[model samples]
Target: MNKDIRNLSDRIEAVFPKMVQLRREFHQAPELSFHEEKTPARVAEILQALGLKVRTKVGGRGVVAVLEGGKPGRTVALRADMDALPIQDEKVCDYRSKVPGVMHACGHDGHTAALLGVAEILAGMREDIAGRFVLLFQHAEELVPGGAQEMIADNALDGVDAIYGVHLWTPFPYGVVGLRAGTLMAAADSFRIEVIGKGGHGGLPHKTTDAIVIASHLIVNLQSIISRQVDPLQSGVISVGHINGGQAFNVIAERCTIEGTVRSFDQEVRQFIKQQMERVIEQTCQMYGAQFELKYGWGYPPVVNDSSETTRMAAMARRIVGDDNVWEIPPLMTGEDFSYYLQKVPGCFAMVGAGNEEKGFIYPHHHPHFDFDERVMKTAAELLIRSGLGYLSADSPEVTVGNLYR
Candidate 1:
């Protein structure tokens, strides 16, 4: 590591306590989706305290902060999502969610706190900073049409050369950094199928079309699209997360609603899944003398990391943690809105290892029991800050002027 970065890393240790406090506060009073009323205000306050220009209520409770460095160079943006899931907090720690059904089960609370730490360290070194820095505290990443798209529409990347973001992952061991060049995460899409049929008395089953039975058959057929239709080598998932239908056990329901998500790395496969789902639903409903309505929602695209940016991030990660700790992981079917930013700029999205078996922080993201070793927050902050500085210092031929510093 260079002397300057080594020194900066040391100073980041001083803010460790603050980072832990911020993360705990976020975990305790977790907010859901677009309802992050209190979180954005706190983010803005911290950014303002760091002497940076802060904007609030961006893209629905999202916050953006700008820190202009003394030196002139390309601008880099650092982003952290700030939304919790609707799952109940199952942990017994003092920092457990006070909100009954909202929890930071995805480690987004840590991501937000780490970005705040990055903002503090970067603001302190503004005089030495090679370029301007944009700090994005985004909201509603857990929902469809993420805040990143809204922020971009609000011109968040108007003058940014490159952007960077990270996910604190639990599957990997602590201190390891995961990076990939192309298609790091899949594109996520959702669909809702409402089957309409006739209801009748429980004693006379012949009179009812039976929407529940049609929905059941539709669900079983949908699995064939992935297992038989889609290529075995290609990746795709069709999961039914919700099923709403009848109230009473004896009543033959008139309507049944099925909601689920589809994930794929390839656009063709994504489209194919949607097409097959609609076809199966329509055909199955028709055979059962029922009508169906399909509501398909397009979501975040595949997160494809720029080759140059991925290479640069790998180097930075290796410098911070050893080379052996920096690893190339396979692409994931999971989705991230950060893909929206990469679509507009040359950037890399990575996963920072937060799993520590001894610390009992090894649960997967979005799980009710999900948690991570807080010490990884420091490592994440340092990697982000260093990568921003490094990207600003180096110029790549692949980063075109059309997408940079607009």
Candidate 2:
């Protein structure tokens, strides 16, 4: 590794314990979605102490901190999601959620702490940098369509040249970071199908067209859209998450509801799946003599990384953690709101390893018992710093808007 990068790693290691403390504090006081009032206030106070210009409530509890460098160059952004899930805490740690029904089951506590750690380090090394550093503390990540879109609408990415974000993944082992050049995460879109039919006695089978029967047919046909309509190589998922029909067995309900999500990495595939879903729902309802209504909800776009930015950041990560610590993992079906920022500006989102077997902290995201090893806090922070600095220092633009659209 390079000397400067090694020195930065050592510096982050020295401050690792403080980052753990910050993470624990956040873990104990978890907040949900747009209601992250206390969380963003605490973050703003910390960033202000670090000598950065902090702005609060950018887009409903979203915080953006600007740290100007000694010299003028491009602007770069580093982001962390600050919202917690609605699950009750099941872990017996000292920092268990004090909120009755809210928990940091997705490791967002670690994400916030890691970004704060970067702010501290960059504040101290302001002279070494050549451009502005924008630290984004985003809210409502778990919500569909995400807080990122709101943040962008508020001109959070106006002057930003590039951005970087990370998720603390417990599936990978400690000391290993996973990344991909493009389409690191899939686009998550939701659909709801409501079928209306005549209500009649269950004994009179021929008297009414059953909505429950029509909903069942719609579910099966929706599954076939991915298998028969979409290309097998281009991945997509259509799962029926909820089905509600008649309340009692004796009565055929007048209405039935079917709701599910669609996930895909490619935009074309996403559109195809949506079109096929509507076609199947409409045709099946017609065959059963029922009225059908479909509501397709759009979520975050796919997180497609800029190759140049990812290559540069990966090299920096290998320097901070080691060549053996970095892995080129395949794209995931999970969605991230950070994809919105990447859609506006060129950026990359990487994963930080926070799994530790010795402490039994290996649960996947959103699980009730999910927790992460606090030791990885420093590593995640250092990677963000390195990626931001490296991208700002690069001669050419990491990614252009035209390239990203393509």
Number of the top TM-score candidate: 1
For candidate 2, what is the TM-score? Answer: 0.90
Please write out the lDDT profile of model 2 over residues 250-287, one tens digit for every residue. Answer: 99898999988899999999999998887888899999
Per-candidate local distance difference test: 0.89, 0.86
State how far residue 329 of model 2 sits from its true place (Å).
Answer: 1.7
User: TM-scores of all models?
Assistant: 0.95, 0.90
Clashes of 2: 0
Query: Which regions of candidate 2 are displaced past 4 Å?
Result: 1-5, 200-208, 249-251, 395-406
* Model 2, position 50: C-alpha lDDT score: 89
